[model samples]
Target: MEPAGRFITFEGIDGAGKSSHIDTLAAAFRRLGETVTVTREPGGTPLAEKIRALLLNDAMDALTESLLVFAGRRDHLRCVIEPALARGEVVLCDRFTDATFAYQGGGRGFDAKVLSILERITQSGIALEPEKMRDPDLTIWFDLPPEMAAARLADARAPDRFESQPAEFFGRVRQGYAERASAAPQRFVRLDAGQPRDAVWSQLTGSLVQRGWLQAGTSDVGASAS
Candidate 1:
C-alpha cells in the first residue's frame, strides 16, 4: 500500500522565520527524493491571493477581514491542498487555521465561537470528500515572543496591516497559539524561535523524524538527530 500523504504546516506570527525554515525543509525533503508540494496561506490559489490583498490592505473591519481569511482558506484547501494530499504528495503549508485562532480570535478580540462557525462553513463542504478534512498531520509552531517578532518585522519593509497592530494585540495572538497547542498537543509541535537558525533547524528535523515522517538518516542526516 502507498504511504498516506502528509499535511504539514508551519505557523507563527509575521517575521517568525517560518517562511525561511519551510523553504529549507522543502529543499531538504527534495534532496531526500521526497515528493513535496509547498504553499502558503491567505494566498495559495488565485482567488485566495486576491482575498489576501484585501485582508492585508488598509481599512477593513476586523470581522470582515477574518471572514475573508476563512473564505480564502476554503478555496485554497479545495483547489490546492486537498488535491496534493490525495495524490500522496507531502503538503507543506506556510500557515493554516491555527493562525486564524491566533490573529483573529486572539489578536482581534474575536470569540472562539466565531472561529468555530467559520471553520464549520469552510470545512463542512469538503469534510467527507475523498482524502478531505484531514487536519494537519503536524503543525510546527515557531514560538517567539511578540517583541522579537516585532523586531524582525521592523527590519523588513513597512509592516503590513496585521503587522502594524499594537504590541498588546500580538501578545494576545501568542496566547491564542499557546492555547491551541495546549488543546492539541498531539498535532502541534512548538519550536524555540529564540535560538539561532541552525539550532531551530535541528529541532524541526528531529521532530519530523521522531514522528516517523522521514527516515532517521537521510539528507536530513544530522539535522534529525539534534
Candidate 2:
C-alpha cells in the first residue's frame, strides 16, 4: 500500500555506509507494512541520471559539476520526489542538498551564495514553495573521518571524481557536514559511523523509535536536521 508520511534522507560521506544501512532500514519499514519509495539525489529522475554521470565523471570542471548537481536535483524534485512525497510516501534518499554544500562549499571552496542562486533558478518553476520543498522529515548523517573513508573506498569500484579528490578536501567536507548539522540540530541526527555495522544499526533503530516514525519498531539524522 502507498504510505502516508513525507520524506526521510540518509546522509553521509563516501564511505560512511549510508547505502548499506539504507537497505537495512528499508527492509525494516517493509516488515512494518509501510510503503516506501527509495531513491537518491543527482539522479532520481531520468534527466537527472544523465546529469549525475556528468557530475561524477572526472572530465567536468568543478563549477560545471556543481551546477549539474543542482540541475539533477531540480528535475528529480519535480518528476519523482514531489509526487511521491505529496502522496505521503516515505521517500528514502541516499543524498540531497547537503552533499552539494559539503562537496562544493567545503571541499571545493565555492561560495554558498552561488548555491543559493542556483537553487532559486532551478526550483523556481515548481509549485512547491521554498518552505515546502521536498526536505527529509529525518536526516541521518553517518559520521566518519576522511582518512578512514578513503581506505574503505580503496576496496571498492573505480573512484568517482569526488571520491578521487585529496583526503584534505574530504576532511573539510566532513567538517562542513558536522557544522551544518550543528547549525540545524532539529533536522539532523549525527551518528558515530566508525562503529561496527551491527552497532551502527542499533543506534539507527534507536533514533527511529525516538522519532515516532516507526510503528512498533523501525529504523532511523542532522543540520538543517532531518
Candidate 3:
C-alpha cells in the first residue's frame, strides 16, 4: 500500500500550533507543483469522521478507544490516503498512528504491545505485508511544554475528551511524542513551539528547505504565483 507520493504528518500536544501551520506548508508544496492531500487522523472519510466524533466526545475505556481509532484509521487509509498517494500527491495529515500511541498508550497507560498488535492488524490486515503499513516519510513534531500548551488552549474552545485531560496527562503525551521522535530521528524534525510565531515559522520553513522540499529563494515567488 505504500505509494509513490510523500506522506508528511504533524504531531504535538494539543495547542502546540501544528494546526496553525499545516495549511501553510501544504500551500508551499502546491507551489512546488506537488498535488497535496490534506487530511486528519481518526477522521478522513465519512465513516471515519463519524468515528472521530465518537472518539473525541464519547467516554470510552482505553482499549475501546484504541480499537475505535484503529478502525477509523483503516477506513481513512482505504478511502483517502492510499488513493491520493497512489496518484503521487503529497499527503499532509494532521495526525496519524502517532497520536494513538501518544494518547492511548502513553497518556492512558494502555499496553504498548497490544497497540502494536492492533497497529499491524489495522495497517496491513491479514495480507501481512510489512510495507503495507503506511508510515509518514516525514513528521514535524512541534515541541512545547504541557503547561504552556494548556495555557494556549485555555480560551480556544470547549475541551474534547482528550483535551479535558489534566496537565499531567499532557505531560505523558509530550513524552510519548518525544520518544517516537527519538526512535525515528531521521524521519522527524523537532521544532520548539514555545518560540514566537515568526521564529517557529522560520524553523519550519528551514527544515523543509534542508530536506530539499523547497528551493531557498523560490518559495515565496512560487507560492504567490500559485
Candidate 4:
C-alpha cells in the first residue's frame, strides 16, 4: 500500500512565482489539521544542503551535476522525505527529480536515458520494495512564459548559477516541465502563476479540497500568511 500521507511537489522555472504560494498552501493544510512537512530539494538535509550550495554557485559539467543532484536526493529520501512520509505527514516539496530532469537533462542538454537510470536508482525502494519508485501524488506546475520569468527575475536578487542562465535555457527548462506534465497529466496540474496572487491561492487550495486532502470551504489564508 502507499504511504498514509500524500506527497505533493511544486515545480516551475525560477521567477515563475511557484515559491510564493508554497507556505500559504502549507498553512492551509495545517488548518485542515494535517501534519505538513514543507521542504525543498537539493537542500533538505545537511549533505544535500552542501550539495545545493555547490550546485547553485560552482560550475560543473552536466554529468557531474547529475551525479551530485542524485546523491543529494538519495540522502534526502532516506533522511527527510521518506521518513516524514512514513510518519503520515503530508510532504509538500519544492521541486524534486522532475527538476533534475528539467534543469540537468533539458536545460543542460544532458542524456535523458541516463537521467532515467538515475531516477530509477535514486527513487526506488520508497515502499520498502526495491522496484517501487517514489513520486508525487500531485505536482503543481506554475507555468509562466520565459520572457515574463526573465522580467520577474530581473530585480529579484543577485542571480545564482541556475537563476543567471539565459532566456534560452529557461525556455528549454519550461519545455522539459511541459514534457513531464504531458507524460503524467493525472499526477500534474498546471497553474498560471502569472495570475493574481489571490487567484492563484484559490486555485491551489481548491485543488487540494477537490482531491479531499483538505476540507471544502476551508480556503481562508491563515493570519500569519495572509
Best candidate, lDDT? 4
TM-scores of all predicted structures? 0.91, 0.89, 0.92, 0.95
Q: For model 4, state the Cα shift of residue 74 in Å.
A: 0.5
Which stretches of model 3 miss by more than 4 angstroms? 125-131, 218-226
8-73 per-residue lDDT for model 2 (tens digits): 887778998888877667777777777788999779988999888878885866588778898889
* Candidate 3 residue lDDT tens string, 64-168: 999999999999988888788888899999999888899898999899899988988888832225556667899989999999999999998899988889999
Clashes (N, CA, C under 3 Å) per candidate = 0, 14, 0, 0
Regions more than 4 Å wrong, model 2: 1-4, 121-127, 130-132, 215-226
Query: Residue 81 in candidate 4 has what lDDT?
Result: 88
Question: Candidate 1 has which clashing residue pairs, if any?
Answer: none
Please, what are the lDDT tens digits per residue for candidate 4 over residues 98-118?
999899988999999999999
Over the stretch 29-115, how does candidate 1's per-residue lDDT look in tens digits? Answer: 887677899999888999999998888885877688788898899899889887787777889999989999999899987889978
Model number with the top TM-score: 4
Ordered list by lDDT, greatest first: 4, 3, 1, 2
